[model samples]
Target: MNWIHSSKRFFNNFQREILAFIHRKNLGKLSPLYDDSKWEPGHWYAEHYQRHFAPLRLKKLKILEIGVGGYDDPKAGGRSLRMWKKYFRNSLIYGIDLVKKKALEENRIKIFQGSQTDESFLRDVLAETGGLDIIIEDGSSSNEAHIKTFKTLFPALNEGGIYAAENIHHSYWPSLSGERWSSLAKGSIFLENWIGCGGSLDLNDPKTLMNMYKRLVDGLNYQDFLRPGYSPSYFDKHIVSIHFYPNLVILYKGNNDKPSNFIENNALRPFVLEKLGVESLEELGLEFSLDNSTPECTHLELSKR
Candidate 1:
């Protein structure tokens, strides 16, 4: 029976390698391969990932995905890791999970066991990987975990790399809060009451992962912010673009040094009025009663200087 199972596994792996080679040769759709796997259906993520990943299919890359599937079962997961392996022929695939999935280790694939929010664990993983070309946050699916893991691992992502968060709809679920729930008998409440209390669904909540990423959108235009002695956050200086999809967000990492057309050194240039086809606010049918005491007016006056 062991021999039979080994033969079957070998045959499956060989078949997949052949299919993957043909798929790469023909520029085939990834949806079929995703649908064939236990990771997820093609409709959920394959197309969106294809749009972003297809270009890099031939590149030798190191990719990390958080949360190997099958939960606490050590030997039962690695479906998505296998999918990624087939998809990126030239790439090495790595997965992190709380469970030790040493059984899933294969050629060009590795697994690490640790909390996603642990910087030390992640740093050690990076030591082995050198640096990551892509990172997919599919762990735990809690708001706090998303934010913390991103903060920990994003800095290690290579320049021009891609960082993606998956299952972000969990950010809106009341059940999965910033931390995992112990049980309803302890401190957790009923779903109805949780919703009634605004729960994690509140868009204004800073603790939610979606809101955290939304804040990064402003960082994309950090140069346009008008303030004295303004300093750009690390994200503001590095996050070049962010794309939102259903249950997913992809952030492109690179130099975000594009200066604002109308501003330089955090001061509005006088030529901005000319660019707007107006010499002054009055010409543009706009009026402001400047009050020197107000910070708004002070910035305005400073811009004029």
Candidate 2:
């Protein structure tokens, strides 16, 4: 866009062949949601990945992508990590994987080879990147890796920063799922994975009396932040909350508490917000394409807390 307005569009389109390859390998692993037309994450949750991260205008910040594999391979979606550099100009985008490969090497993409379970390796990366504004863990598809990384980095998260773990459904898979420890982390509070404690907000069941209190956890109260009607951020008054069908979501962590639902605010401290980066996404505008004509992939419950 710096050169010409014409440059604005998805820079890549060779995703179809890569999609075909992933499907053949998974062999209908996505049959549950695939309607003989669209594809699911196969080995990787593709649509959900875009839903969760692609939209945010992360400029002038540091982003760490753990387990970023071959973007050309179906799992990595034959994509380029340099796009992250595009999204964040003053940003230092780093990618770490078990093995260092080609897709791992892209514009401004710092590569690190190590296990997420290794504390020294993680610290070394964080130390090199200086600090992170966002951390996306899409590695090995292991729950242990997710948990271990979270324990190590969540506290390191820059105030109102974002820490995202893709394919979290692995947390439920018996073997790789590991064990559900406590709600405590090294520095951050472990939020019950959206499905955790008090998460069963079934429409069939009546709203609990306690959740209707005046002082919501994160803010003054639901009524205080209301503009008049619209249900006030829908029970849980998160900044940008979207629960797309089965599993996909995009939520901001404000100063709230653990297991906070509709009324309860889990934001214990203030959020960081983004800095004035050289590459501000403000020009990018809002990227969530909700147009009806654009078919949205239904979210699948891959992992639950």
Candidate 3:
């Protein structure tokens, strides 16, 4: 058994070295997705990131990626950091891993030793880097760590920046579901249901981060609802958009301070009332009458008849 493990390690290291050599030679000429020879292994995100990061390619940017690989091997991590350095060119890449990867630090890439779940450690990293333009959470797939990291670092993202969490399918697996506490449940699961049902969950239970997010998603169309005592969420005011992809969630942070308002266009009211077999707007609790003077008056008159 010991010999088998040793042989496996030897072959893996040999392959890694060969790939690293090929990657170093090609460097900026090839896309990270196309070049499997590169040490970084996120072929799935390459195309997506290329499209999203096109604008920031040449610009000086700060990026933080949680979870450097190599696990127990101190010398084996920082593949993604190196990839980012090559791909972004001018961008500074910062990576944090649970294990020490200080040996992997180079000109534009820095590796910090820390756990993604530690709020204070994350804050320290942010302090050292000042502000971040991109935050990628690829750390421990444990739901608690994912939730804690997002809650801690998302607000710190620069306005108009992006926060992306990968490998979110772990929410469904029993090992990573964080079943011990509801708040620690996979965010992807929460988001799936929240978006599908349009915030039908209880809002009072702050223990579940999903509930909080549900409220924020609700805030997008808050004016349409009748929750009298509910206050607006910071995310509601700042999150420009939430995008969900397979095993991924991207949050776009921006100025979303615009108040949610209803347009007074009643163009569809006549058709809707006719379909419902309703006579007066009073049935719908609306004061305004759909008379002939209304824009859809012909339809309204026809419906009344």
Candidate 4:
């Protein structure tokens, strides 16, 4: 039994080593474009990036990618940084890793060593980069780490820029947090709550990033519920759109300051008048009156008030 167990362990280790070697070797050949060609063995982010970033490729943008692996081996990581540098020829690429990766530094590609959850470190990096046009959160999968990184960096995205969080499926697994249903890391829960899924929320929990998003969404529509003593949300005028994918969430930043307007028509007024026994248009406070003088000449016109 001991020999059998040892053999199994050895086989697993060997397989891991072989796969790592192949990945390292193929990393150099993959291109963000050219979907028909064979892709290097890695996360299938190239196609998504190609679609979203095609417009900004030629712009001189500042991009930050969190989590450069290969922990202690400084010479081993920064594969994504290199890929970004090649893809965005005119852009500067910045990468952050928990371990020191000074060896990966090169022209147009800078590597910073720090934790994704460290707000101060993240701020310093932002200062060094002079603000960011794009941010990709590919760091630790812990719920706290994801939330911290997002809260710290998302606000820093430039107007008309994007923030993408990848590998978000970790939120649904117990190994990353707790139970799938109760876990705060679940991306689905965040999206649901943001879209106004009715439920009570624990606002104090660190895993409650969804609550933040929900509040922002409410802020966007605050004009509808404006009343006495109402406080405004900071993101109410900043967030343009929130997009969700299988294991990803991308946020676009833009001016969302336009107020929503409601255009009421007479299509539904007839139903109310016929079914509820309404006497006159004044009961409904409707400015438009329905005219049925003739079937061919019937029309609804606004009243001069």
Candidate 5:
């Protein structure tokens, strides 16, 4: 048994070296590198990744990818880690899985065994990595896990870092995604039966990772929200951009403090009314009272008429 394990280890290392040699000259696109490492195919995710990753290819980075490829079998995964290491030549690639994969670790590549939803374990990993420049959540394919892991890890990511959620299409699959659709009208047979028939693609499902990310989009414009005393959530203040792809969602983190031209201190500025050729708030169809001391419309009250 010991000899068998040794043979497997020897063959795996040998195969890695051979593949490395074969693809040593071709380092143009990440898709080819994925193929070289026998990870997910190029057609699946290469284009989107290339668009985002190509710019950071040369920078030294710390990247963490949730859900290393193999299941239960400690020796079966790490394909994508190798691919990432090759693509980001100056990066430290870290992967986490439910099963221990210590055998897969190599220079510039580290593996941790833990559940994605375990906050403590994630924090420990973050401490070891110091901080993350990029995080790719490809674990479990469960929307619940995706959302949980994201909320826990995204805040730990460095400013201007990239956070990506893969397999988000699973949000539509009731069985695999663990997202529950709201119950339809019990009184209406047609509406109740039609709900979740083929699979729920409910954009309103707040539980799904997709909708959660979609909601974060509004955060990018937190400066423009007209609500009084509205405090931007951590996500709103830090999430600078959100990009949605087929089964992927990528978030860019940065300061989101850009003020809206029309608003000041959360109130609509008086100049906006002048630009609209309105002498008063009434002329603009906004039933709002101008502060007796200031020209700015501090309180808005819509006319019933």
Candidate 6:
């Protein structure tokens, strides 16, 4: 068939579903999809997924992404919706968006029309789906939407499943700058209540997130933290960034009592790789370190609720 004609992201088995998701989001927000010309991986969603999705495997995974059915984003392109259907066949896929019936494959893809701020709706979905293996928040770019999802759905993810939100640039949207920690900011509104492992966001004060926001803003700098020239866009607007790039970030869902410490600056950032006698960012072109590998990481951990 035309499988060979597909993009390089597509292989004999894997089809790059996230790329498809990106393109579709781009379409709903921006323009129309013509010839799958909207997205380019190295550019859009690269920093996030490069290390974000490599949780080791995608086979037989269950995935969900909020805020679907939009125009192409400056980063993700069109045909992204359909592309997801192609790549992640082994997995059961579900999506939610402001508008209904617009997600790429409605027949094969389970979709819901809703808002992330709707806790009842979110909890209901999770109840039915059990727990998602990978949950993406590319849905409504609203601050409240983000906060709501963080407060609610993230708790429903499997122990090792990932919960991510994209286009957090809106958190730092210039128009929203002064209003950052205001009642309107999503993280400010919701994340405040999550308890930390040493700090989880679950049992937080709700108002405390603003304080974290202050710390996040303080850390927002293109600092020369590591030995290599790697820096992740964090693709986030709230903080200057998460960790350096060429490496991905892994934030643990520590415990209901305390939040995960990975949210803070990397203690490893200051140690020069040269002095430590390493090559690249850890001598590997990876986004994280040995301690920060899959199941065990110093920066992230859920002690238990």
Candidate lDDT (C-alpha), each: 0.71, 0.43, 0.62, 0.61, 0.70, 0.44
The best candidate in terms of lDDT:
1
- Residue pairs with backbone atoms closer than 3 Å in model 1 (clashes): none
- Model 1 poorest ten-residue lDDT run: 296-305
Model 3: per-residue Cα lDDT over 66-168, one tens digit each: 8776666789867777777766778899998877889989999998898777767766777688768899887775555666677677777787899887765
lDDT, candidate 2, 1-305, per-residue tens: 56554344223223433453354223233222222211344333444544555445445677787755442242342133444554355677777766555444656767777877777777676666664667766655444445456546644555456755555344333331224533332222123222232311332221221121112232324332212222333223332322222322223445432332322222221221123332433333534322211111111122111
- What's model 2's overall lDDT? 0.43
Clashes of 1: 0
Off by over 4 Å in 1: 1-18, 25-43, 176-199, 270-305
Report per-prediction Cα RMSD to one decimal: 8.9, 18.7, 13.9, 15.3, 11.2, 15.3
Tell me the tens digit of each residue's lDDT in model 1 across 65-128.
Answer: 9988766577877877877887788999999988799999999999999988776777677777
Against the true structure, what is each candidate's TM-score? 0.76, 0.44, 0.63, 0.61, 0.74, 0.46
- Estimate, for each residue in 111-139, the C-alpha lDDT of model 5 and write its tens digit: 99898888777767776787689998877
| Candidate 1: residue 227 lDDT (0-100) | 48
By TM-score rank, best first, the candidates go: 1, 5, 3, 4, 6, 2
Best by TM-score: 1
Q: Give the winner by lDDT: 4 or 6.
A: 4
The Cα error of candidate 2 at residue 225, in Å, is 22
The better-scoring model by lDDT among 2 and 6 is: 6
Residue pairs whose backbone atoms clash in candidate 4:
none
